[model samples]
Target: MGCASYVKRDEYDATIAELRANDARHDQRLDQIQATLEKRFADYDARFAQFEGRLHVETTAHFAYGKAEVREADKPMLADFAKTLAAHHEGVLVTVEGFTDPAGSASYNKRLGQRRADAVRDFLVSQGLDADQVRTVSYGEADNRQIRPGAWGDDGLANRRVALVIDFVEAVAAR
Candidate 1:
């Protein structure tokens, strides 16, 4: 009986030892899983930060005129538009484009169109925007407004205005 009792005690001790080893292995695996999850979360956080930094917005505003002359009332609108462009100066650019009607010679119209763009560019510069921040271009007698019904009397006036082009960094990169 004594021998049998001693053998049973020895078996019980071995079973407990094996169970403790198994538990230790399971604990180690749990710790590894936790570490992996933490690493993934950190990686995701960094990616999201990069995405937020790259995010941007773009908008276009139009200013029109008659007889190729800018209206005094349009001053405020132009200023506001300039401000909008300034807001996007970080990784963004503004294009001041001028257009003219088909009434005059293409060469003359091109020069006039350039003047219109230059005027807008100068105004924007005066309002605290950098001259380099805006680019001026002219499209003479091109990009006219289409109208089929009525006789286009002074299509030149509407064509003789400046158009704003706001481009963001991401958009430029995509192109």
Candidate 2:
């Protein structure tokens, strides 16, 4: 009976040792997987940062008060901007935003802003830019930049203009 009890104790000890070894192996594998995931995430973050650095925004367009037409003097600037956009044909997005002063009625200002944005967009398209890449938005009087007391003339003119925002899409790495 004593010998039988001793044998049972030995078997129990062996079973516990095997379980401990298996647990150690599993923990090592889990640590390896965790390290791999961390490395992958760090690589992704670095690549995304590099891609974001290449993106750009430009507000180079402006307009006159109560006018939706692109001025003759500004046409050359728009043409140059279009040439720049053409050079970067890879997933470029141009947003033409029209803003107005707080002088006209809300509804009227909205329509005027829309017309101004449309005019700028049309000019860009005519200058060999992709129509699909160019989009228009009317800020009306909501985004007035000359809202100070007794502001007029040049101050108001500053608000009554179109802004061109240029953005680029993520560039995929070549194999």
Candidate 3:
């Protein structure tokens, strides 16, 4: 317990300048991280969308016709994605939404869609993301959702994909 004194002008100025310098360094570091993340997203052709007050990172992993397995080439991208998302962002809920081409009965396609979503969800979990944080859904040959509507077989390759979606508040806030 000692006598209190007001902060001197010079001392206050110096403290503020130091704080500003620290803030600048923090900003620079954040900028660097942003640049790296942007490049990574571009490499995977990932894009962002917002709706219903949530932000989503929309990227797809395609599967072969009548198959739910994730392709070998897509695994690396998804693995890195899992590592990055789990490492940086907390409280992220990923919805592995699956789709299928219109080549089978509606019920069969729906089941196939679900299998696709589950496969991606499992893959992401295997890649290190918490299983509890990822969920699965199936659109099941929704015409409007199709990249090439009513096209099945090889032409429907784009349709046979699971679109990984992340709904995170921090992502929206940062934007």
**Taking the tens digit of each residue's C-alpha lDDT, what string does model 2 give over 43-130?**
2211111122232223335567678888886787677667655763436566787877777787998898899999999999999898
Highest lDDT model number: 3
**Model 3, residue pairs in steric clash:** none
Whose lDDT is higher: candidate 2's or candidate 3's?
3
Write the residue-wise lDDT of candidate 3 on 22-58 in tens digits: 5565445444434555567777866665454344555
Off by over 4 Å in 3: 1-37, 169-175
lDDT tens digits, residue span 1-175, model 1: 3554445888999989986785565445334433543343342211111121121111122235324455576666566555644553444455677766665577986887788778778888887677766778887667443112222244434445566554444444545
Candidates' lDDT values, in order? 0.54, 0.63, 0.79
Please give each candidate's TM-score.
Answer: 0.52, 0.58, 0.73
Per-residue lDDT of 75 in model 2: 80
How much is the lDDT of residue 98 in candidate 1?
75
Question: Root-mean-square deviation of each candidate, in angstroms?
Answer: 23.3, 18.4, 9.4
Ranking by lDDT: 3, 2, 1
- Candidate 3 lDDT (Cα, whole model)? 0.79
Off by over 4 Å in 1: 1-69, 143-155, 169-175
Candidate 1 TM-score, true structure as reference: 0.52
